[model samples]
Target: MSEKSRFEYVREGAKTRDGVDIVYYEPNLPPGSKAERRMVRLVAFMLLLSGLAALIFVAAYIWWPFTDFPATDGWEYKPGNSFMKGYTPILGLSLGLALFLIGFAVLIWGKKLMPHEIALQDRHDGGSDPEERKLTGNTLAFIGEEFGLGRRPLLKVALLAPAAGLGAAALAVPVGMLIKDPHNPDELFRTGWSPEANGGKMVRMMREDMTPIRPEDVSIGGQITAFPMTADGLGATNKYADSPVLLIRLRPKDAEFLRSQLHHHPVNVGGMYGDLVAYSKICTHAGCPASLYEQQTNLLLCPCHQSQFKITENARPVFGPASRRLPMLPIELDGEGYLVARNDFNGVPVGPAFWEKPAA
Candidate 1:
């Protein structure tokens, strides 16, 4: 037959269902051609692979070890923490592959098995006629009547209870955070270095290995990261992020300078332990570790934002975005000569100040 006649034949052979016309642009395959069979297998294989990937995603999400495992410096991939390190990447790959394969399978099925054709439909620009609107409203009313809600008041009340409860539950999901306090405001102002945290006695400063640091342990013009040596014997790890303090043994000239600065600002001297001063390692601006010490310049720098704190001037912010000084941990030598916190930070909260923090 001619191309025009064949096209006409195909269009005429189209069917309609539920007021919608269904057109097919291609004829059915004769028995089973190898090419058509291969296409079918390829599409099925893609769909099966997609399903397998989805199942793997679900399994990994549920069974993978995602807990904080022992690793050097918190996040490095060591043999002990390899599973934890790979958990997130595996989840992303599995889920992404599942979604990608499903879409690919649909594309292949359409291109290989289905015919390409344009659908035509009559379009009306304005709102539906009054008759159609009336019919739609009547249909909705009939559905409501079929529910028998008006006639059965008790059933309607029961249904309303679930709807109201569900709505409240949905609202609570977002509103719950505002209502709840995740961390205590009072606790935020305190740390493991506080005297109360160590059985109402002085808390000793220790190294990362939990050994108590004596004044002699730190050399002049050098800084050592210290933590509160609590009764638990877990100095740094016990309090983790909040308890680290920079113990700087200043040179005689710098110490004299700091003493001079203290005379003018007595509150800044509250945490000074003579020549060996202790300050919070956390930055006041963004809470990045302000631990990069420049012994020559007497400056403590936060690597994250280049915030400079002059160690001689009460760890005061000398440059960058930091607006406040690093809160000093009140230090003194105990009876045994171990460097210890004399008291909690003199009323000033450490780290980044929030709206709840009182104005300095």
Candidate 2:
């Protein structure tokens, strides 16, 4: 007689697959039973919950207001739009429910609707025989059948729809971030220090208390957090968050060393007012506030990543994760003797670098 087909051999010998010996196997409610049909419908409905969740995530991510400011193209929303107040919670709940529902559906399918079987396999080494390989392939098909893959179309389609949606939701996050930043591209290159932001007048560096800071206000070997008066003084730290600066009062000797450094860029030439100089408080590494100033070592430290900038060397990174020098806010004294920025950060954008960021 011709050799039996692999599936037929396995099916005829015992209800075994691969090398496993089935000592016992039983179906819960028998094939196509009325009660079993109800279980399949229930599992199918539960599995579909994940698909609905995926739709919620994708819709909210695309259509919902996630930014306080309106788009450059002038979307109808007002500045400080509060619609996105629920953005984080919505995304969290939708994505979380999708993950949980998919898992729960699979668990219910396994424990409630699937066949119960006990099988034992003898130890084997290396690759299985050709017959065993065919048996293994058939075994997977058999398991799918037990899950109603062939006999029930509803269960098979139910699993596929949610899987595709979950994948799309996963991809939307990173792709959406790459689309645009907090605002327009031009906004990234300008700050409150820019003359345009101040009705074309130079911006005076003022303290957080909204008081204009004179050179005398900052003592030697000390620093103060400052903001452009045009940026509503320090209140702009909320609107123009990147406008905050670390205004330092270096020792006369340290100031001299900085000006004398031959390799120092021309931006630092008139960037100082006597022994006082200012740098963007935002770290170029990850935009953390590089606020911890070490007057003893003349170094500026970023508490977030420990990135250090040598104040005596034009705030260039001398240690840690930062590579780019902190952008100097070219400062000088106005006729009234209040410190003012010469221009917006010497043509370099402040804070962390982006792919489109121009070189100094």
Candidate 3:
């Protein structure tokens, strides 16, 4: 057969017409040559090293210790075995070495024993010719007939079962997430701020750890952050999300004017606690934690979008994207004489107004 015919018939699909090809060669050595024996031994050594790395990878997987995070009291996410610390790095090194050794072995075998050659083949546009297509079609048809799928329905079903099982395995992963309710889009909107939380009782402000605030923590002409002190206390993180209050100690004269000026202005629960008022720390613009207070100017600034709020009158937005006033956190002293929130914001959504609600 001609060289072209040999390539088409025997080595069909061996190489593309881009002058690239893969060849396998058996070693050839002159008799009694010590160097030839040494080369074979070196190749065997590399193969053994690759096998040893693979074994070590399996051993590490079964025995190595690993920790995902600094341990939090009861949260142990990983198995606490001794080898865990080095588990991942050892596995990576072993796998990488195994692959490198295999590649290096093949390159050495090629350089030491394989004969090299350069051959040319034809390249054509579009696709294979009609004759080649006919040949491929006949080959596929021969294989189909040999399997006898049309005559053996049981064999066809058996072959399809594994493929269907694989497809089902892929779909099963997302099934758990589909169990969530599709209808509750506004679940996050409802909170302890709902009227039912208080039974018309006051919503007292507390700290992140559920301790009520004292007027002393907030210096005169200064501000402090506070959260709702609900029955759930510090455990109620969600309530605290919307309950941040900027407790401002106003000048007595300004505080007196503010009480009369703003409708539903905050008041001191007792005789000595005058000029102390708490307003929602949540910026009316985009609900940033508006904690940056300018003591002299009495302006609260949200770093996120520069929404400036004037605290002297009420926590009213004086500049930027914020149009509404910061929601006032009503305050009163609890039994221990510590400041606490009187109630949630009176029916006002503390953040930016929705399309349904008018701008302040």
TM-score of each: 0.51, 0.64, 0.43
Best by TM-score: 2
The alpha-carbon deviation from the true structure for residue 280 of candidate 3, after best TM-score superposition, in angstroms, is 1.3
lDDT of 3 at 301: 94
Off by over 4 Å in 3: 1-201, 264-273
The segments of candidate 1 whose C-alpha lies over 4 angstroms from its true place after superposition are 1-185, 238-240, 357-360
Model 1 error, position 272 (Å): 1.8
Q: Each model's RMSD to truth, in Å?
A: 13.8, 6.1, 14.8
Ranking of all candidate structures by their lDDT, best first: 2, 1, 3
Give the per-residue lDDT of model 1 (tens digit) for 10-77. Answer: 33433221111334334233214676567656655665666566566555544343234321122234
How does model 1 score by TM-score?
A: 0.51
Q: Is candidate 1 or candidate 2 better by TM-score?
A: 2
User: lDDT tens string, model 3, 77-196?
Assistant: 245654354656786897678667757866775676343434445666887778666665664454344322442344344434333433333342233112222243333243344433
Residues 1-360, candidate 2: write the lDDT tens digits.
Answer: 998864455555434435577667677767788988898888888778898898799777765653444443222334364665577789899989998888888897788777787777777688877976776777678767655578789988998768877887977764454443444445547888988678788998888778898888888899999988883343355666888999999888898898786255775677878888889999989999999999999989999999999988888898898878888888888999888998888677787755555443
**Model 1 pairs in collision:** none
Whole-model Cα lDDT per candidate?
Answer: 0.67, 0.78, 0.57
For candidate 2, report its TM-score. Answer: 0.64
Please name the candidate that would achieve the greatest lDDT relative to the true structure: 2
